[model samples]
Target: MADQVKLHGNWLSPFSSRVIWALKLKGIPYEYVEENVADKSALLLHYNPVYKKIPVLVHSGKPICESMIILDYIDETWPENPLLPSDPFERATARFWIKFIEDKSPVLWGVFLADGEDDREKARKATLEVLQTLEERAFGDEKFFGGDEINMVDLAYGMLARWMPVIEEVVGVKLLDPDMFPRLHALAENFRQAAVIRDNLPDHDQMVPLFKIRREQLLQIAGK
Candidate 1:
């Protein structure tokens, strides 16, 4: 197939999930190639030599690295289900929030990678700040960050909707409280129940055990 698309990604990765969401939303037919990050394959390394990472989208055999960048590429390639806003100001505003989440991503993930209790607490605090910012400043009265529909910003933040609770359950901390962050909480529910997003989320049961093992491995490596 000359127009064949292939995605090299892992189920455990939020980044990969975002790309998957974008592809499904756009109704693009593609082959999924699962990659184990622990032991990288020659194909994965060749596709993404700079990062040697997952979520690489191969369109017509040309590889595009980075999840966010791949989403943009998908949106551009298939303009039917537009991920970005058509209006210039709205698009700019959307991109602003997209950049915000990208920068603050480490803060949210730190909780999972933190070894000690104190470090985990600190990471939780930072994660709360990021979530609070999203709740307060990001989305106002919109059902989603994209206003009634899932946009690029939502795809960027959508990982938290499905995966955050699992992380909280595994790490034993509740940060995305309903009362504390009403808008974000509602958005999470709405996001999960949305069209493509609903059917394409990761399983909570499977993710919990995998994340636990990963956190333990990370802690041991860091401790050494």
Candidate 2:
């Protein structure tokens, strides 16, 4: 029998998208099982007993949890169209940016979920600062964080490119303005148009409405 590969993922999750992108880039044929995070399935729990999260990559019945870990595994397993750089120094640099984004991603989410004016403003500012630094330092004039083509680091930061606008609409704030963040905005647009990214991206039309509703629900709970 062919190697049975399955991915447990939600349609809207950027975390899940990470796994999807890796699989697609590697030309891996796998079954995608839509997982409802709210009322998670027993199978998901069985696979990822510790986290109980979506994006459990089940390869030959063994599960790999966590989006980044899954990406690393896919890269190592496939080796074709490599995502991480070959050079140790370059690989370390890519890992550094990936770690930075992972650590700071929560602060960006706070811009959507923050209740009070003070908190919202602070979160928004921090998020903007993060974007500015990334544009200046990471990409600069290169096509991607990895330079020339997309890589693991590029995929890691790709959410900001596509989802930030949807988030801006939902939150009623524009963080990645063309005037203020020209390079960042251009980079986002560039990534969105890339062949691999374009084909693999989530449906923004479907996501914007869901994110809007989710943001409103969160705001209500926070008494915004």
Candidate 3:
């Protein structure tokens, strides 16, 4: 029998999109099971028992959780599109940035979920610090973090392309300014325009309402 591959994901989730992009890039065929994150399914809970999150990849019955982990698994399993660099040192460097962004991503989400102006400002500042570091040190003059072509680092940072702008719009905050981080802005534009990314991205119009509702719900919980 053919290898059975399945993905549990939510359409609006950036984490889910990471796995989707990796699978699409590698030209792998899989079944996509959309999860209602507000009321997750028994299968999603079963597959990702620890996190109980979306974007879980089940390859022939074995489950892999976490978006970055799923991406790495897909890359290692497929080996066709080659997400990470072949060189050991280069791959290590890519992994470093992936981990860096993954660690700092909560800051951006905090900004999104901030209930007050003071909290939003603090979270935005923290997020900008992280982005500035990437702008100055990570990509440098290269077109991408991985240089020239999209790779694991690019996929890891894909949220900056599609989701960040929506967050900025919904929250009425401007973070990714062209004058402040020109290269990073350009990278976001370029990343969004990439074939796989462009085709697979969630609709911004549809996401705005969902994100707004989620932010309100989160803010209510925070206020409580």
Q: List model 1 lDDT by residue over 1-224, tens digit each.
A: 57899999998888999999999988888899989889978999999999999989998889999999999899998999799989999999999999998998888888888867788889999999999888888887988878877889889988679789988999999989999998899998999889798788888888899889888898898883
Provide the lDDT at 121 for model 1: 88
Each model's lDDT comes to: 0.89, 0.86, 0.89
The clash count for each model shown is 0, 0, 0
| Weakest lDDT window of 10 consecutive positions for candidate 2 | 137-146
Which residue segments of model 3 deviate by more than 4 Å?
none
Candidate 2 lDDT tens digits, 1-224: 24788999998888898888889888999999998877999999999999899889988888999999999999998899999989999899999999999998897787888777888899899988998787677755887666788889878888887788888877778898898888878777888888878888887888889998888887788676
* CA lDDT for candidate 2: 0.86
Candidates arranged by lDDT, highest first = 1, 3, 2
Tens-place lDDT per residue, model 3, 110-179, is 7788767797899899889988998888875777767788899999998898899899989999999899
- List all candidate RMSDs to the true structure: 1.1, 1.6, 1.2
Model 2: residues with Cα > 4 Å off, grouped in runs: 220-224
How many pairs of residues collide in model 1? 0
Which residue pairs overlap in candidate 1's backbone?
Answer: none
